[model samples]
Structures are given as structure tokens and as C-alpha cells.
Target chain A: MANMYNDKVMDHFMNPHNVGELEHADGIGTYGSPVCGDMMQISIQVKDDKITDAKFKTFGCGSAIASSSIATDMIIGMTIDEALELTNKQIIDELGGLPAVKVHCSVLADHAIKSAIYDYAQKTGKHYKGLEGFDPNAEEEDHHDIPEEEE
Target chain B: MRQVYLDYSATTPVKKEVLDAMLPYFSELYGNPSSLYSIAAESKDAIAAARKQVADLIGAGEKEITFTSCGTEADNWAVMGAADALKNKGNHIITTKIEHHALLHTCEFLEKHGYDVTYLDVDKEGRVAPAALEAAITDKTILISIMFINNEVGTIEPVKELAQIAKKHNILFHTDAVQALGNIAIDVKELGIDMMSMSAHKIYGPKGIGALYIRKGVRISNYLHGGAQENKKRAGTENLAGIVGFGKAAELAGNNLQAHIKHTSALRDRLIEKVQAEIDHVYINGSMKHRHPGNANLTFEFIEGEAMLLYLDMNGIAVSTGSACSSASLTPSHVLSAMDIPVERIHGTLRFTVGDMTTEEDIDYVVSTLKNVVNKLREISSVSSKKGW
Candidate 1:
């Protein structure tokens, strides 16, 4: 089988370029499953409206580790708006395309980045636009069946 | 490029001799075993010969063997069939907590249908004691089903002693011996089991075929009732090619079990030794002494099994966390959890099983690769945690 990961991806997994977090990060995101054997924690530092530093810690597969490592590298110098636009497909492409079965790991990276921005926006309570990337209709569908709690 | 494969407990490569024995059945002996014509008589004789081979391997009579698609179906038939047939006598069935999902899930299914089931627990080493089993039995217990050997931790159960207890109580005994057959020498008569399941692919035989040994005078209902096949027990045109392959595999195992044990045990022990000596914070999951000669289940803390598997894949080595059936669920292995291993260690468990084809060079490559990957991941995890993000 061909190596699905590029040298950059393997390098990041073997020697991740940017790992760990700033002591006082502007935002952080943590997600994954207890059922599945994977978890991810991402943190970012924003200075002057641009992501000056970004890092991640992933408890997942080789593809998952490589995907998060490359994803953190891609967002380090970009504005929050630019970083928010990054997609799972682009992350997979950066890794030379992961196995189809493992593509979900890339999706996890995309979600982690967006989740951090969501955390930042919620904390600041500012009219942040990062929530646009997340599916809005999903919230409506999920909340429509809310039953009042029993007293 | 050479790749290392450690998932031998899932399935094995069909030996060349077994393949050759099966090829003629697919082409020249294409006639159905059920057909009464002279051409079909050859097929019938072939099946009979294969039946005798299967019986000889396990110390059962030729009449006791009935072929099924795989061990899962056989397990279902044994549990559900016995429950339905003996409903007037009893509504309770007994099995162990560490049974394969083939048996575990079937027992749970029986529960929904008003049949009560008792799932006895195994000790820390994954061994279900005969004393524990005897304690769980009651007047309403109609059947006792336990696996001969665990597929994950390689813990060999006290099947013979448990079977004797069930026999004394007049309860039917069934065992899913898919992992035990060919690896361990078995004598069904001596064990006093009423029913036992075997899968061909577990040994060096073709997939999609297995057998169940039903002792004479034990009545059970049929799962498939379409045709008068398997003596009206299991229906469908026989899987002749696969069964022939299964028989050949069993015969070969019967002839070469001693040599196979020595070869696999040597490789397994060497791998275990290397992993223990090289990897830090690592622990073996099951019994060190009382386990299948071909198995080594280890937990490397801090990192997950999926991560280890991917890194190993990059180095062309293949292993598993547990049984292939539950690999996708990501739920820390229920067996490991039952053993009271910490939650963190549960995700890190790796099951490396050896086979007749494994070589020392292959074992060396796997050990070296695993040591490198585990050290890297642990370092990475510790460094990230200390950053206080």
C-alpha cells in the first residue's frame, strides 16, 4: 500500500511542528469519543486579529495525529476568518489523502478548529461570525422537541 | 515489502494443502450432497469422509457433526434452540460474561423473549471458574454455554469441569470452541459437552463454514427449517468446498498440533519478552501462565490502540486491540473493563496473536517497530500535558 500521508504529514506526526499551548490562550477546543479510542485538544493564541500561535494534542490514529499537526501548521499565521474557512478535504489533501475509512479524523480536525472559535465567541459574547460554518438548521431540528422538565 | 501481521486470532491464511483438497469439490464434485443421483453420491461420500475427519479431530461420532455458515450461527442455534425446545422444562440459561458476542448477544436476545439468563463473571485473568459456574446454576437452568478459550485475552476456561457440573444437573452444555479447536487438543466425550461450535477460518481453512457437535439424545429445535438438510437441523445446500477444506485443516491440525504449539509459543514468548523489557508503563492484560500459546494481550498506557495500530501499519505491521467483531465500536473492550483495568489503559490495549506461519524475523520486526512508536507517543503526550493548555 502507498503511504497515504505526505512527508510533511509524517514529519508532523513523528515530530509535530507545533504542539502544546500558550499559558494564556485566547481560545481552546476539546472533542472526541470515550467509546472510540481517540480524543483531541486544540488551543490557539490570537494577536492583533491574527492567529499568532496554534497547537494541538490528539489521542488518535497516525492519520488523526498527522491531520491535526498539519491543520495547526496551516492556521498559525492566518486571520481567524481565514482559519475558519479551512475544510476537512483540504486537511486530507495536505496529508496526501488519508484512507477512506480514516477520513473522519480529518473531519475531526475541521470540527476542532471551528469548536475553538465557537468557544472564543461565546466567551467574548461578541457578534462573531465563525458560527456560520456550523450547520444552523441542525440546532433548530434538535431544539424543536424540547420538553419542559418535571418539577 | 514485508509486512507483519498480528491479527491471527481473527482468521488465518488457508494452508496450501487445505486449498488443494477443496478445489476438486468446487469443479469436478459439483453435485449437491442432497441429490440422490450417482453423481451426487460422490458428493455425499465426500461430505461423509469430511464428517468423519471433523469427528476424529474432536473425539465425537460422525453423526454428531452438523455444518453451519460460521460460529455465530452455530452459537445462536445452540442457545436459542435449546431454550425453545426446553421451555416447558426451564426458562433460564447460564453463560459467562466474557463470551464472544456470538454467544453473549444471543443470550441477551433470549432475555427479551422472556427467558432469564445468568452471565457469570470471569476473574481478573479472564478465567471463569467451574466453582463460580456451579454457584450460578439453579433448578430452572436448562443450558450452560461457555467458550473453551477466550479470543481476546487467550484465557482458557475450565470447560471440562463446568461441563461435568451441568451434566450432573441434567443441563445441556454448549461451548463456542472456535478459538480452542486446532490450538488445543479436545476430547468432546471426555468433556461431557452436549453441544460445541467450531469455525473453519479460525484454523487454516476457508471462511464461511463451521460445524456444531451435538451429542446424541440431546433434542434441540432447528434455526433454518426450509429443507431436510443437516438431518433437519440446519437447512441450505451444503458448503461442500469449505467443509472439505475445514476437514483437511482439522486433520492437518490433529497431525501437527504439537509442532505448531512449539513454533507459535516460541514466537509469542519472544515478542512478549521484547515488549515488556523495552516498553515502559506497559502491562500484560491476561494470565501470564494460563493462556493460549499463540496470544499476548498487552496495554501500553497513555496512548490509544488506534494510534498504535496506524503507526504499526506505516511500518507494515498488523495487529488488533481485541476481537475484530468489536474493533469498530471504540467502547473500551468490555472484557478489559470487566477485569477492572483503568479506563485510560482500556483504550491502549493491544492483542498480538501468533500462528503457524509466524517467524522469528517477523516477531523481531514487530517488537522493534512497536517499541519505537510507543516511546514517541508517550513522550509527545507528556510534553503536551506539561504545557498546561
Candidate 2:
């Protein structure tokens, strides 16, 4: 069962690059729920339209925690538009790959990124193309969009 | 890295004595028990001795035991066979909500086949009330099946009282005693249990071997059909080596029952006491007084179970969890849920079962490792911070 996740996922889980909260951050986004067994909170510090720092605290399994860890590491130096374009697929690819049931963990990471950007947009009265049709409130349903396949 | 095995309820390592007893059957004594030859007679005699050994452990007659593939098969045979045999008399079956999936799924299958099943609820400690079993019974109720000891939480049900209620109603009573076989003393006659399911592996015997005990005069349909094995009820070639191993294991267990229980219970108590003393917001899941000696189910307040299990695994310690993330179905344990544990708490539950292999040093290592793991997990857990723990 340890082989369910690749070395990268285990590495990220064991030694997460960015963890804890970014105090007085520009934006904060929390995705997933306790009821569903995976919850993540991603905080970002944005400066001049680029993310200066990003950190996360996750309440989830290995994959979810690894996804959040890697997602934070990926979006730290990117501009808001570049961060918005960061997909769950990129996170999965970066982490080698997750089990099919755990693909939703990457999806949660993607949503957490966008939701944080949305919160930043709302705070700064700024809007971007990626923000179109993005509803942070729909996170509960969005994480469930990935069909949970039995392993 | 230190390796400590504390998941004995999941399965135990086969004892050296059992393995030595089984070695000959795989080579020299390998013969079809049904064949009318000297070699076959040896095989047949070994099976008979094994049957008696198993029966002796349970205070049952040799004729009452029927070997099956595993405990699941024994449970399947008991519930499905009885439902089919008693269908003419009734279609209703009574069972507890905390049964192992072998019995619960069998009851579900029976439900699909036009049987009405009443899933009696368990108390917060995972105990099924005899009154609830009595209330669920109807004129059409033909059978009542309950687990002797719950697999997840280690709660031992009031089987004797529940069986008495079934006997009063003239309904057949069955108990899945897979976890109870070597851990506790059992007398089918004393308990009024008409049928009981058992597995070998849980008692330090080989896997892939199980048995069902049918009290005399209780008629049930056959589960398998082929050769005339197992008194023509379960049909299949015998697992000779496995049966021999089971016989040896049962004999050893019977001889050392008190010592095994004392050793395992001491280790379990030490582990629990240390964890409770060192950890905060940890709750034991089942009744302390009425549980299997080796079993301890603990719920860590703010962290999920799989994460802790993985950490423990990395430390070379083995354990089990009732968390949804660890389960194939992506749902928390039904047994914990049925016991009225909060859904979030169910995700945090872990089961540690000690056995003959466990030691005081192993228990200390587990407690220390668990403290570090729980503290580390809680450090990053949002739930823990939210609860301000």
C-alpha cells in the first residue's frame, strides 16, 4: 500500500516545502471539508501582482497533504494569471502521479489555489480572465466532481 | 527501525508448533481423505482428530464441526444456509448493526432474496441490547445472528442473553466467533448457540481454513455442492495442511488460554494506560470491561486515522484504522458509525490488538511512537488548531 504513492509524493508529505499559515496574508482559501475526510487551507502573500510567499495547512490523507505541499511550492513566484493557470494535472504530474482515488486531492489543491486568487481579487478589487465562471463557494461540490473510483 | 506487531485481531502469525504439525501433511500424508486406502485412512483420521481438536476448544461434539474455506465462508454458510432452510417457516432475520461484513453482507444478500432483516442497533459502547433483539423478533423471524466480538471496536456482545431470547422464541441463533475462538472460552451448549462461525488465522493457525459449528438437530441447507466432504454439507477437497495447523493451534490455545489472555491483556492495558496518560483528547471507543483482552480502539480527537497508520508503519509498527480514507469504499467504519460515534471521530479511530507475540517492551515502543506521531500530526492539523487543543 505504500507503493500507492510515488517517492515524490512521499517526499513532499514527509518534508513539505511550504507549511503553516501566512500571517496577514493577501488572501486565504480553504477547500474540501472535514466530512469528506480532506480539508486544505492555502494562504498566499502577493506583492505587485506576483505571489511572494505561499503556505498551507491541510487536514487530509498523504496525497492531499502532498498535493497542498507541492501546490504551494509551485505557485510561490508566479503572477496571479500564471498561478490561476496552474491546474490539478500539473500538480499530479509534479508529484509523479497519485492513485485514481487520490486524484481528487490534486483537484482540491487546484481549487485551493484559484480560491485564494479569487479571495485576493475580491480584496484588491482586481479581476482576471481565470476568475471567470469560478465560484469559490462551489468548492464543496467542485471537489466531489472527481468521481471516487474504488481501488 | 523497531517493528512491533499490534494488529493481532486482523491476523496472527502462525505458531512454530502449528507449522511443524502441518509440514508432514503437505508431503508424506498427502492423500484424498475420501479414497479407501491406508494412506487415505491416515488423511481421514487426521481430519477427524482435527475436528475433535476444534470441537474440544469450543466444548462441542466432533460431529458438529464442518470445515469451510475461511471465516467468511463459515458465516456465509451459516446465515444463507439457515435462511434458505427456514424460508418455509419465516423470512425475517435479526442481527446487530455492528456485525462483521461477512455476516452483514450475507444478511444483505438474504434481504435481496426476499428476507426481511432487522438490524438491531448497538449502544455507544458497541453492545447490542438483548431487549432490542427480543423486540426485533416477529413470528416470521427464523434466525438471529450476532457477532461474538465486534471486529473493529472489540466489544463483546451479550451472546448468551441474546441466544436465550432466540431460544425462547424457537428461532435459530448463530454467532460469528472468529475473534472469540481462542481469546475467550466458549460453550455452544451453555450459550445456547445453534450455529457459530470461526476462522483459524485469528487464533495463530494457518489462513484459508475455517469451521462452522451446527448444534445437533438444527437443519440447514448446504453451502457448497460437489464431493461428499464435510458430512456432505460443504463440498470441496480438504485443505489438509491448513486443517492440521488449525488443529495444532487449537490444541495449543486451549492449553495456554489463561496465560495467553493474561499476557495480551497486560500488554494492552499498559499501552492504553500510557497513551491515555500522555495524550490529550483521546477517547477509547468501546467498553473497557466487556472487550476482547487484546483489543483497544482509540480515537485521536483532531487527526485522521490513515495518516497516523502510515506514520506508524514507517516506524515499523503495524496497526489498523477505521478511517474512511483507508477503506476501499471511502466510508468510515460502519461499526463505529452504528455505535453513535460522531462522523468526524470515526475518521480518527485506530485499533490496536495485542497477542502472544506482543511484549511489554513492544507496548512501550508503540506508546512512545504514537505520542510523537499524534503530536506531529496535530501540529499541522487544521481541526486541532480549530479545537484549540
CA lDDT, every model vs. true structure: 0.81, 0.89
Question: Model 1's lDDT to the true fold?
Answer: 0.81
True contacts kept of each: 0.18, 0.50
Per-residue C-alpha lDDT of model 2 across residues B164-239, encoded as one tens digit per residue: 9999999999999999999998989999999999999999999999999999999999989999998898899999
How many angstroms is residue B108 displaced in model 2 relative to the true structure, after the best TM-score fit?
Answer: 1.4
Each candidate's chain B TM-score?
0.96, 0.99
Residue B140 CA displacement from its true place in model 2, Å: 0.6
TM-score of 2: 0.97
lDDT of 1 by residue, B274-355 (tens): 9888877778988877788899999887677766776787788888874211243324577887777776667778899999
Evaluate residue A34 in candidate 1 and report its C-alpha lDDT on the 0 to 100 scale: 29
For TM-score, the strongest prediction is: 2
lDDT of 2 at B269: 93
How well does model 2 score by local distance difference test?
Answer: 0.89
